[model samples]
Target: MAATGTYTETFVELIRRASAELPAEVAEALRTGREAEQRGGLASIALNTILENVDLAREASAPICQDTGTPVVWVHHPTGVSTRAVKADFEAAVREATARTYLRPNAVNTLTGANTGDGSGRGIPFMHFEEWDEPRIEVRMILKGGGSENVGAQYKLPDGKLGAGRDLDGVRRAVLDAVVQAQGKGCAPGVLGVCIGGDRVSAFEASKRQLLRPLADTNPMPELAALEERILREGNELGIGPMGFGGSTTLLGVKIGVLDRLPACYFVTISYMCWAARKAGVSIGEGGELTWLS
Candidate 1:
C-alpha cells in the first residue's frame, strides 16, 4: 500500500515538535523544581538557567539541548496498516528533519566512528511498532540525550555489594544507587525510568520506554507507585541538586515498569533523562486530522 504525503508530513511535524519543544508535563516539573530551590542559591540559579533555556528553545523552535540525542519511536496502528510503509515514512521525515536542523547528524558508525550526516544510519531512529485494535494511529517519540544516556544503569538481583536481594527492597536499593552514582553527570535534576524485571536488552528497552509516561501520572500498581514516590523523595535528599551544584532538588520524577523474568535472573534497569525530557506524541485519524498528546 502507498503512504500518503499527508502521513509523511505528519511524521515530519512530529519530529519537529518532539525535537524543538519540551513536553508540557516536563516543563511544569522543571518549573516546580525551580520554585522548590532556595532563592539566590546555586541550585536556584541552575534551575533558572534551565527554564530560560527551555523558553528560548520553544519560542525559537530550536533544539532544547545541544545534544539532540537519539530518536526512539513507538508506533501503534491498526492491523491493516503497513508497518514497513510507516517506517519508510518516518525515515523520510528524519531526513527532512535533519536537513531542516530539527535534528543534528547524530547517527554514528559503531566500528568506524563516522557520523551519518543525514541522521539515518544502521539502526538509527530506532523504531518499535505494535498492532492495535484502535482505528487511529498513535506515534510517540522520545529524544534521549547522550549525557543522561551515559548514566543509565543495570543491576542483577541478590547483589552482594549493596546487600540487595531479589525483591522490591532490592530494586529500590539499585535505583537509588544509580542516582547517587550518576550525581550531576547526567545533568540533574533528572527524571528516571526504571524496569523491575526483564532480560538485559528488554530490561533496558522497557526502562527507556517508561519515560514516555507523564510526570504526573501514578502507576496503577500501588506498590510501584509508592516506590516511585519514595525514590523521587530520596533522590532529592541526595543533595545532588541541579547540575550537581548542590541543592534541595535532585530528581524531577520517577517512573517504573515491571516485567516477569526467569527464576534465576532478576534485573533492574535504570534509564536517566536530563531535565530537557523532550517527549511528545500525536494521534492521526484516518481522515488525516492530528491530535497532540504528551
Candidate 2:
C-alpha cells in the first residue's frame, strides 16, 4: 500500500485503533462523570475505565465499541490534484471496507428511510469531503456515535451583534443556554464545539473542524483560547456530569472555530455531548489509497 502512494494502511489503522482506543477516553469520562455525582467520586471510575480500556485495546487491537459511528471523513485535495472523480471513487472504497470489516451501515434513503443491503449494518460510517488549497490528500475519519449527536443546536440569535444588532456577548450566552438546556441528556462529561462565523454552511464546517483539533493543542489567538478555556471551565461548572448521572465535569473540553461573517447575522452552531467522544481519524493518498489512524 505504501509503495502505491495510496492511504490503505492509514485507513485500516483508523478502524483498528478506534476500536481499541475509543473506550479509554469514553469510559473514563463516563466513569469520572459518574463519580462526580457524589462529590464527583464516580469520575474516578470513568477515568479508571479509560485507562484500562486503552491498555486493553492496545493489547488487543479491536474496536472500542460495536457502534463505530458515522465515519466523518475529511479529504483535502491539493491544487494540482484532479478530484473531479475522486469523491465518488472514495465512496466506493468506503462501501468495500464496510462489507469486509462488517461495519454497521448508517446510510438510508431519505424518501423511503430504508436501509441499503451492504456491510453497513443498517446505519454506520458517514463521509464528508472538501477540496483544500494544497497538493496532498489528507483524510480523517471520526467514528462519532449517535448518543451525543442528539444534543446539538443552532441559533441565528435575536438581534445578534454580528448582525450589527447588539454585541458578541450574546453568542456566548446562547452557548451557555444551549448547554443548560441539554443537561445530562447528551451523556455529559463531554466536549462543546462551536462555529461562530460564516453562513449556515461554512459556520457548520468550522464547528465540525473544532472536533478535530488535537485536544492538547492551544488556539493560536489568545482571545479565542481564553474564550475556549472559559467555556470549558464554565461548562464543567454546570454540573451536568457523566452520563447525566450528576457530576462537576460537565465537559472535557470546549473548542470554538470562527470565521469572519458578513454584516448580517452571527450564526452560532453548537455540537455537543460526546458521550465518550468515540472518534478516530486517518489519512488517504492519491490514486484512491487509504491509511489507518492511531
Candidate 3:
C-alpha cells in the first residue's frame, strides 16, 4: 500500500499518546508497587507522586515526563509498502509532535553539543522496519528517558570480577548488579528489559525491544520466564525501594529476550525503563482508519 498524506497526522497522534500517557500494564504495575510499600513511607510517597504525575500528564495532554527521551519505533508494514515513504511520514510526524510539545526537542549533535530543536537529527527517532504479511501497518513506540538510558548496562560473561559464568546465573548476576548500581538513579520502581547472548549492538537493541512487551506477559521460553520472575522477586528484596528511597518496591517488572551469540561472546544487555514507561501503538488500515493498540 502506498503512504498517504494522513499517515503523518496519524503518526503524530501516536507520538502524542505515547509521550503523554503511560501504558496500562505499566501503570497497573506501579499501582501494585505503591500498594506494597508502607503507606506513609518515603517509597510510598514517591510512588504516590509518580501516580499523580501520570494522571496530570494525561489530563493536561502533556508529556508524562519532562525528558521525553528518544523515540524508538518498530514498524510492521505489508510486503509492498515503501519503507522510505513510511520513514518520511515518521520524520514529518516527529517534527509536528515537537512543535505541539507532545515531544521535547531532544535530538542533539553529538560532537557539536547543539540541540536539533525539531527532534529530527540524524537517527533521532531510532526506527526498525520489518515487512509482514499483514494487510495493515502496525507501529509500536517507546519514549525512553535519559535517566534510564544512562543506567543501562552491558556485560561480557565469564568474568572473574562478578564471578559470572556464561550461563543463566551469570545473566542474573549482571541484571542484579545493574539494579544495585542504578539504585534510585534510573527513577526506581523501574522495569528491566534484558537480552542474553547477542553481540554488543544487537544485544542492546534486543534488550530495548523487550521493553515493548506488556508488563504482565510471560516470556515464551520457560527458562527465561522463570528468570524474569526470579529477578523481579529478588530485585524488590534489595531494599532499593522507589526512587531509591529504601523500601521493598525496587522493580515493577522484568522482561527477557535472547539471541544467538558466537562461542567467544556471551553478552548480556539490560535496558532500564523508568516508571513512566511511555509506550503506545496503532494499526493503520488501507483507508487510513486508526486503531489504538496501547
Cα lDDT, all candidates? 0.89, 0.63, 0.91
- What lDDT tens digits, residue by residue, belong to model 3 across residues 1-294? 434555899899999999988887788888898888999999899999999999999999999998999999999999888888888888889999999999999999999999989988998889999998889999999999999999999999987888899889999998999999999999998989999998988988899999988888889999999999999999998999998999998998899999999989999899999988889999999887889996
- Regions more than 4 Å wrong, model 1: 1-6
Residues 1-294, candidate 2, lDDT per residue (tens digit)? 112324344554555555456634455545555555554266555555555655665676655545556666666666765443444444455565566552555566667878774534332444555678655577665666666677787777664433322234666677777788788776566677788877887776567668877665698877778878877778788776655555676787778888887887777788873655656655555554555443
In candidate 1, how many Å is residue 64 off? Answer: 0.4
On the 0 to 100 scale, the lDDT of residue 173 in model 1 is: 93
Worst 10 residues of 2 by lDDT: 1-10
Q: Pairing residues by index, what is the TM-score of model 3?
A: 0.97
How far is each candidate from the true structure, as Cα RMSD in Å?
1.4, 4.9, 1.7
Local accuracy of candidate 1 as per-residue lDDT tens digits, 1-294: 444455687888888898888987777888888888899999999888988888898898888887888889999999798888888888888888888898898898999998878988888789999999999999999998999999999999899999899888899899999999999999998989999989998998899899998899999999999999999998888989999999878898999999999999999999999988889899999887899986
The alpha-carbon root-mean-square deviation between model 2 and the true structure, to one decimal in Å, is 4.9
Off by over 4 Å in 3: 1-4
- The candidate that achieves the highest lDDT relative to the unseen native structure: 3
* Candidates 1 and 3, the one with greater lDDT: 3
Q: Lowest lDDT 10-mer window, candidate 1?
A: 1-10
* lDDT assessment of candidate 1: 0.89
